[model samples]
Each structure stands twice: as C-alpha cells, then as structure tokens.
Target: MLSQKDEWVVEELVPIREKVYQYLKNEILKGELKTGERLVERELADKLKISRTPIREALLRLESQGFVTTVPRKGVIVSQISLEQVLEVFSILSSLEVLAVQLATERLDEFMTKELDELIEETNRLLAGNEDEEISQFHIRINNFLYKAAKSPRLYEMLSDLVDYIRAFAHIGYEVPGRMREALHEHKDILQAMSERQIDKAMKMTQDHIENSRKAYIRTIDSVKKK
Candidate 1:
C-alpha cells in the first residue's frame, strides 16, 4: 500500500486514469515495483483507495504501451523486455528526437536562444555541484525546450509513446559509469550549435547525444548479463 502522502499525490479529480498510470509507472521506474511482479488489480485499487475501473483502464493502457502484460491465470505483470527490444525503442527515440531538434533548429530565434543559454548554464551548475537527484529533471527541461521549439504535436506524441515502452528500465543509462559527464557535455555542445543557428551541426549532435545514451544502456545490460 502507498503511504498517505503518496496516495494523495496519486489520486486526482480529473483524468484519474493518467494519474493512476503515472503512479504505477513511477513505481516501476524507481524499482518500487520490480520486474515480473504481479499487478493484482484489486490490491492496487485498495492501496490507491480507488475503484477497480480506473485501475483496469490504466493497466490496459500500460499493456498496449508494452509496459505490462496480461497472463492466463497469472494476472498482470510488468513486462520484462529484452535487450534487443530496449535497443529498438532507443533507436526510435533517437530518430524522433533527431527530427524534433532539426525542426527546433529551423525555428530558433534570439529569444529562444537566450532561453536555451540560461538552461545550459543552470545545467552546468548542477553538474559541477553533482546534483545527482536533479539529473532526470535536467534532461526533461532540455527536452521540453526542444519539444516546444519543434511545435509538432504528432511527433511529440509518437516520441512519448516510444519512451513509455522503455521507461521502466531507464535507470540503466543513468547507472552507467561517467554517464553524467558525457551527457552534460553532449547537452552543452548540442545547445551551443543550436543557439548559433547551425541546424545541420545541431541535428547531427542531437543524434549522437541520443545514440550515446543508447550505447551506455547497452553496456549496463551486458554487465548485468555477466552476473
């Protein structure tokens, strides 16, 4: 059962299904809900203090996104996606984000460049101070900048869906050695190019940035396999 604070955070008045899904998704990503663990719908409903209908809806949605699976007589379990599947999702993400950054580059203006400069500076500060907890949040901030500048709804939706499929195991890249330094440098370089209106350079750098993350995750997988 979730604690009182967590329960409060999970339940919302509108769009209850998305809240439920996000709650469970966070659980899986943070390893609170382990891989292959059964998702007993009734227990989740009782724990969340909600009716089973929304829980069912969330589970079905997660299943379609490849986050969970329904088994015969075994109930629902977090899907243990293979390494190949992980790479495939990352490949899709790289392509989608490449397109996003390209569009964002084309639309870059002085105002947006200033906004990006501030972001990169703050990101650098966090990295220098070793603000580990803010790593994911920092990445989100950068991605949001590109996402907004890109101004493509359908592309964003597709990228988000592909991300959800592999998010449960996303810690792999973060756990890799020297990932923070590498990723931070990548962000700085990519943004510098974008701010200078070097669209082609920015596009290639963004592709390399995402591809580096994919490679880091693969290394993490290989290490785990050896153990």
Candidate 2:
C-alpha cells in the first residue's frame, strides 16, 4: 500500500473528527501502521492537533469497521487481513461489480463512453507508476458511475464501504508482474462491451476482471509466505 496519511489529513474538506478518522485509517490501510501495531491516542491527538475525545471515538469506529482491534492491554492495534477474509470480501465484490456493470451497459451512450475512455487513459498513466492504491481510486470512480447509471444508490453505498476493505489489499495485486497493465486492459474491454450494448459480454468481462484481480492478489500473498 502506498502512503495516504499525508493526503488524508490535508485541507480539512470534511468534519474534523471524520478527518481524523480518515487520516488514521489511511495510515492503517497503507501499511504505515502495521498489523498488531498499538496505536497511541495521546500521540495521535498531539500529531493531529486535536483532543483525545475525537481520537478515542475514531479508534472505536475503526474497531467496528474491522480495521483495528482493542487488545487486552495493547489498546487499539491494526487488524490482520487474512486470506479467507480476503476471499469472502472479493466474492461479494465480484458479484456486485458484475451487477453494476450490467446495469451500466443499459445506460451507455456516446458521452459516457467518451468519459470512460478518458478514465482508461488516466488509469494507464497511473499504471506506469504501478500505484495500485491510486489506481483503485479510479476503480471506485468507475463503480460509482456504474451504480449511478444503474439507478442503484443503495448498492453503491454498500459497495462504497466494501471498497475500503478491499483497498487495504489492492497493492498486493499490482506487485505481481504486469497485473496493473492487465487490469487496465480488462477495464477497457469491459467498457468496450458496454459501449457496444453487449450486456452479456460486459457482465462476463466484469466477472472475469474482478475474479482475476482477486486471484492475483491472493497469489502474490501466497508467494510471499513461501519466501
């Protein structure tokens, strides 16, 4: 995972407490706060120039989100992301993405296709750096577009939260050789099918795209364990 703490803490676009949560969660997801690392509230409060109440509240919320855990004496520690948990999350992700893409296909037009082409080009540039987490932002953007076009706000909301969980591990796939480029091509193919009004083909491509991503991420983790 790439560094996100600096980005999350900037300019105060959101509420103060929410900004604190975003900054800490960004640190956790980017592997800056390693699994089992105890989080110091006083230090965090001082670092962010806030009081302890909001920090405590943010930790509790992060705990509820499964990104951190309150240990017996270790306070809040970043949670471990297991392979089984990854599998479960990706299974849901694949299903929802396939549905969203299929629905989006029905709403496709020249304008949206042009927009997707632009997004694909942007992703291609990001892939040059192999910035998986940044590329995943585009993933979320595409999903939001698809869900909105699908007229499924609730589904998008669900996906929005689920995406946080997946982003924690998005970097793993990009570490594998050529995976970023392949993922970009997959997005292009899905968009092409959608533009052509081929719902069946788009759906199939979506499924294949997500499933391949999951496999790639898991394969990388397995290889690391072996090493």
Candidate 3:
C-alpha cells in the first residue's frame, strides 16, 4: 500500500518531527519563550541539539497551529494572544465543552462516571494542599478525560488544538490572585453538575468559568502593559 521511499520517509522523519514539535510546544506553552518573541531557526536548532530541517518543519507545524507567525524577512515570531483572541477562543471552547459535557453525560458508563468522581475527589485533596503544580496537572487530566468521554474525533481534535493555545495564555492567569482557588471551586461545580446530569447547569458553569479566566488573563495583560 506504500512506496518504499514514502514508508522510509515516514519511519525516519515522524519521530524526529514529533520530538521537535513537543519540545518547541512545551517551551512556548511554559512561557520559556514569550509571545511576540522572534524564534531564530539556527538558534533553536542549536538549543534543541537538532538540525535546521527538523526545526523548520516543527516551526511550520507551529505556524499552522497559530502559535507562530512568519514575516518575510524577520522570520518567525510567537504570536501574542490578544484579548480579542482570548475572548473568541473561550467562546468557541465554551460551546465545544458544553457539547462535550452533554455527550459525556449521555454516553458515559457507570464505571467512567465513578472514575470521574474519584478524580474530582483527588482534585479536592490536591486543592486542600498547596500543591499548585499538581492541581494544575490534575485539572488537565480531568479535562483530558472529558475530551475522551465526548467521543467525537473531529471535535476532540479541534479542542485539543484549542486547549494548547489556551494553555499558553492560561499560565499568565495561573498566578493571578485568587485565580487558583476560584478555578478549583469552578471545577468542583462543573464536576457536581456532570455527576447530576444537569446539562444546562454544567454548560453554564463551564461558560462562566472560562469567562472568568479570560477576564483574569485580560487583567494580567493590562497590568503587564502598564508596567
């Protein structure tokens, strides 16, 4: 079904490309690289201990994903997440997540529901402690489970891309005063709503939570601009 050269290319390049992609994506999302910062191909190649070809390929993929923008002469720059962009993304995410909640509620088996309940309890425990990093990881894990429960491959793929974009901006809000606590409460509300199969309440809670996060991020951006 495949040409020898094509198969060889796939075998050799996919792993390297995936590694490059993951490394760059993590650096960007973690704010190790800031928005609007230029990414020099050679510099990244050296920093990543890889050749330019793979670096270029990775950058191209990032560009496609809205994380980077290329200017003709100036090279690639990390695209800043604007307030408008944040609002638009959150709007889409709210709609998608509402759909996900609805689907997950309708389709999830008892075992899956119990698993989510356990995750919520674990999240509660983590939040009770001061482990911010663990809380964030658990929050992401819960969202991943929700995505799986949603069960629409196309929606899942789009949301996955959107979540990555949100993560890049979300790290800014993570330090906002009271944001972590607020998010914890909001997540608990969402989980309770899901547990009760209260679709409307779950959807509204998700929407409100995302809106609050967007506002927090906007405030943070404004403070940074003033400084």
Task: Give the best candidate by TM-score.
Answer: 1
Give me the runs in candidate 2 sitting further than 4 Å from their true place.
1-13, 109-114, 120-144
Tens-digit lDDT string for candidate 1 (48-81): 8788888999899888888889989999999888
Report the C-alpha lDDT of model 3 over 71-181, residue by residue, as the tens digit. 888889998766788778888988898788788877778888998799789877877898877777877887888888887888888888888999986567767887977
lDDT of 2 by residue, 83-168 (tens): 89878888998899888887777876677778867776775677678666676667667767766666678887777667778876
Candidate 3, poorest ten consecutive residues by summed lDDT: 1-10
- Give the poorly placed runs of model 1, Cα more than 4 Å off: 1-13, 109-111
Candidate 3: clashing residue pairs, number = 0
Cα misplacement distance, residue 42 of candidate 2 (Å): 1.9
Q: Each model's number of backbone clashes?
A: 0, 0, 0
For each candidate, what is the lDDT?
0.81, 0.78, 0.81
How big is the positional error of residue 191 in model 2, measured in Å on the Cα after superposition?
1.1
Q: In angstroms, how far off is 117's CA in candidate 3?
A: 1.4
